[model samples]
Structure formats: structure tokens, C-alpha cells
Target: MEQLARLEDLPTRYVADLTQKNLVPLWPSLRNVLPPLKPIPHTQAISWKFKDIKPLLIEAGELTPIEKAERRVLVLANPGHGLENMRATSVIYLGMQLLLPKEWAPAHRHTPNAVRLIVEGEKAYTTVEGEKCPMSHGDLILTPSGLWHEHGHDGDEPVIWLDVLDLPLVYYMEASYVEGGECQPVTNTGTKSRYGKGLVPTQHHIRAKNNYPMLRYPWAEAKQLLNDLAEAQSQGPIQVAYVNPETGEDCQKIIGYSAVMVRANETIQMSPCSAAQVFHVIEGQLELQIGTDTFNLEKADTACAPCFAQVDLINKSSEPCFIFIADEAPIQKKLDLYSVRERN
Candidate 1:
């Protein structure tokens, strides 16, 4: 008891000394303010199975209305992070949202940039600032930060999509802002009428005066490009990043995206990067390796790799494996902290 008492008085003695010297020491706060190394990674390798989540999504659609639910979504929460808040990784947020037939997700806008990767359903689309951008399986739709956007489905089946955002990073920076948008729905024109079957017109005009000029990146054109690239090459995975059609830059300022296809029985080279990445399996099966851990992921399953973690992928299936990825490279690059090294 005497020794414990003496130890407890150390802080009081330090404070007295600090007051006399007009100096505030940080030794007492060192444990939290400065650790020997990174205390813990903000992300971990985790996967969510569509088979497990589909029923719950259907139940949510049946039980809740669009306006009441606000947005019917199941966030992909990382097990290594807090459960109270849903985050796919430390810097990124992901959610699987559902839009049933005739349902309209009301218009809204936020400061954190976002993208939607269509997972399932058909004849549904998201309208961003007066342009109706249709959604299909494997298509990517962009909603830049502070842009007004809303979702609606006129198809016979439910529309499901994986929503990716840098909300966690925005929240960390204390720059998060959100507001209700003008409650209006834009006419659906399916892009072809405006762009001529996925081809950008010579004199195309943008409605929203935002950073990114294009709102929709059609899967038809992107898939054909990937196919053409694969036909010309025979070795490694065919990968392409989604970019702004106008500037050829990243779709969002803080979020990055890529689509990769690995041939059957092939393995991807290991890469160590400074930006965390969340990957969703769009087709086939593959093994994801984060450091010493390995996970088998199938279609509609999501996986994460923390920043600076050595990672690689392997496709042991007979069919090609298609994966969609969201990266925090834009944020890192903006801060001049982005780097990648090949692991030998």
C-alpha cells in the first residue's frame, strides 16, 4: 500500500515541477500520444458473404419503406474496428444498399465522395444532378462530394449495389457535412441516347458544374476494353482504374477505383502499398493473402487489405476471377504519402 501511494503521487509531483518551471511535460500522455510503433492497424482482412446477407436485405425491403429507412443498407463493418460504427476499413466506408422496384431513395448530398458498384438487379439507376445514370451488374456510378444524388428502380427485380465512400476519413478530418437535396427525380435516358452507345460525343456537355464531368461509367464499354486488353496480353491480370472521362483523373477526389480480372489458376504478384484498399469479388473464386493470413473469397464477397500490409491474390478456380476495388490512393496522393513497392 505504501509503494502504491508513492507511485500515485508521481503525477502530482510532476505537475508541481512543471508549474515551477513553466513547462508542461508529455511523459504521462506518451502512451496515447506517442506509441513505440503503430498501436493498431485501422483495417483488417475481412469478408462478407452475399449468401448470408441477401435474406436480411430482402427482409429489410419487405419490412421497411424507402423514406423511413432513408437508405436500406447493410454496412460492411471491419471486425478490427468499432462495431458501433460501420466501416469497411479505417479510412473507407462500405455498405450494401437495396432499392426495390418502384422505390425511390430520396435525394441527398454530403462532403465525403462516394461510388456505387452495381452488384445485382437491373433497369435501375442513380440520378446525379439532373442526369439519369442507369445501373447494371458490374457498372460503376459516381457521386462526387457535395453533389446531389438519388436512386430509383423501375425494373421488376430489386436493385442491389455496394456503396463505397471516404466518410471515415472525412469524419476523422472533421469535414463531414450532409443535407437533404431538392426532392426531384430526373428522367431515365439510359446513356445511349446521350452518348451514342458508350461512345463520348465530340461536343458533350455536363449538367453539373462539378469537378468530375462524367457521372456514369457504363460496364459495356469498360468490359469490352478489358476484353481487348486481355486478348492482346497473355500473362498477368488485366486491370483498369475508373477515371473521369473529362479529365482522365480519379473519379472522386478522395476515393479511387479499379477493376481487375485474373485468369484461372493464376496468381497475382505481391504488392505493398501505403494506401488501404477494399476489394469486392464480382465473379469466380480467389485466395486473398494479407501478410501471413489467407482467405478464400467467392462472388459477392468483400475483402480488405490494410495500408502498408503486404498482400497478394491467387485464382485457383477454373474460371476467371473479377474483382472490384476501392482505394484511398487519392487521399494519400493529395497528402504526398502514396507509395507502392513490389514484394520479392
Candidate 2:
């Protein structure tokens, strides 16, 4: 392939005049904006070990009070995008948040959609729009865009959760902002009890449904479903998508969440997709091969892969391994840019 002309190839006076007029040549940078075969993604495959982050998170809880910090969190920033950016992928933001016992994080609503994957401890609950969703190991709680939510811990130990948000995308669009509010009166409990066995509340047929009908996805239910799927199928990866029970669509508009279970001594090659993906280990251990890099992820650990990267997950443990996945598929599909390359 022939190389595109460089900016230096142009005459100095012409370049100077173009710059003075606040205009620039496109030919010199055309290839960068329109790469030949695939995008040159800035997101690289990287892993964050919980063992290394847990201590720091605990120390943060001791150093900062809930009133001062609001939400004490340590961001899991990907180096490829520059650590200062605090981004896990092009669109995903990953952070490990800590809530010490008897602490409360004030109610606030933000424009960027976010979810919490409970990583450790219990007796903590997130109140979202008047619904109190309890935090449990491996459980997923949604704090969608513009929803008033706050955190409270009742247990003796510290509560920590991995916060996955579409902040970078919202911030890039200049639409990200937060509004603080007083504590909300708990008007409702988690709605997961009303959804099961492919069934939803009968009221949906007669009345209008809430945009986010279910706020909490318990890990116990998801794990049992994964187990049933593994037992029912002899081959292929066992995975279940976390969707909105009312609309039967992706839970959020920007990011899609799923749970994948890898059987003992098994290996699964994920199809290459156009959207970048994040993998958080829920149970057991697994070895992840993202493109050319390999990472051994333990419980509560997290890893991310760039768009269109070849990913392979291997479970060398004696027990089944479960992982929580977050990706840019929902927004990509909305924009008509979602694609999966066929394996050659």
C-alpha cells in the first residue's frame, strides 16, 4: 500500500497560510481517521487485581469520611487511553468504590448511566429512585442516568463494589453532570422478585411500565441459571444477558451486561466484535487471552479488551468460573456500528 502524504511534504508558506486561516489539510491525516481494514483502538487489554486494590480501598475508607468524599472510589484506569483519563475502554469507566460500615453516601443523580457489581462484604444497599436494592456478592445494581441514588452500609465489615459507568461517552458529549439531593424515602423494594421464569408483572398489560422495572440482579439467580444452562448444554459457552424484564432489551442504553460461566478445564474463544468489552471475575479463576496478552484473573478481578480483539477464556480450575461482562454493544447497535467478524 502507498503511504499518505505527510504534513511536512507541503510547502511551508502554504501550510502556514492554512494554519493561519484555521484550516488544515485532510490528505495528510485521512488514513488515521479512515484506517484501511480496522480501527486503531487506543484501549489495550489490561487487568486489575483485587488483591492489590483491596488494601488501598480499605485505607481510603480510613483516610476519608463519607461526608467529605461523597463516594470513595479508586478508578481502574486503562494505561492505553492514558491513566489520567480514568477510562477502562473507549466508552466504559471502571472504579472500585468503598463504603465503610454505618456510612451513608448522600443522594445524587447524574446524567451518565452506571451500575454496581458488588465485590465484597454485605448489608449494604443502594437506593435508586426510591427503590432500595441490597448489595450482595456478585450482584448487579443499576443506577441509571438521571436516577436519584445513594449508598448505605449496615453490615459490620466494609462494602465494596465495582462501578461500571458510561461516563467517558457522556463526558465527551458534554452531557455529564450531577445534581445533589436529600435522602430519599424508601418507597419500594427491589423488583427482581416480580420477574422470573420469563414472566413479568401482569400490570404491564393494563398500565404504563417503569423504564427501569428491575434495579437489582441477584448473583444467586444468575449463577443458578448458568448452572442449569451448563448442565443442559454439552458444548459452547454458557452465558446469560442481563436485560430489562419489561422491554426484554439491554438493561441500559449505552452498555450491555452479561454473565458467562466457563466449565472446569474448558476453553472458549469469544467471537471478535466491534465493541470493546470488560470482564470481571465473579467466582473461581480463569486465564484470559486478549489478543496477544494473557491475564490470570482471580475472584473480584477485572480485565478489559479493545474492539475487534481476539479473546480466549480458559478455566483451569476444578470448579466452574463465572464472569461479569460489560460491553459497548447496546450503543454500537443503536448507531448501526455493531458487528462480529466470522472466525476464519
Model 1, range 34-145, lDDT digits (tens) per residue?
A: 5553344657877788888889999998898887988999888987887666888778999899999998888999998888999899999888887788898888888888
Encode model 2's per-residue lDDT on 1-344: one tens digit a residue.
59989999999999999999999999999999899988999998999999999999999988988889999999999999999999999899999999999999999999999999999998999999899999999999999999999999899999999999999999999999999999999998774556763346665464336788778899999999999999899999999999887778998999999999999999999999999999999999999999889999999999999999999999998999999999999999999999999754
User: What are the TM-scores, per candidate, against the unseen true structure?
Assistant: 0.86, 0.97
- TM-score: model 2 vs. ground truth: 0.97
The parts of candidate 1 lying over 4 Å away from their true place are 1-40, 185-190, 193-209, 342-344
* Clashing pairs for predicted structure model 1, backbone only: none
Compute the lDDT of residue 67 as modeled in candidate 1: 79
For model 2, state the Cα shift of residue 250 in Å.
Answer: 0.3
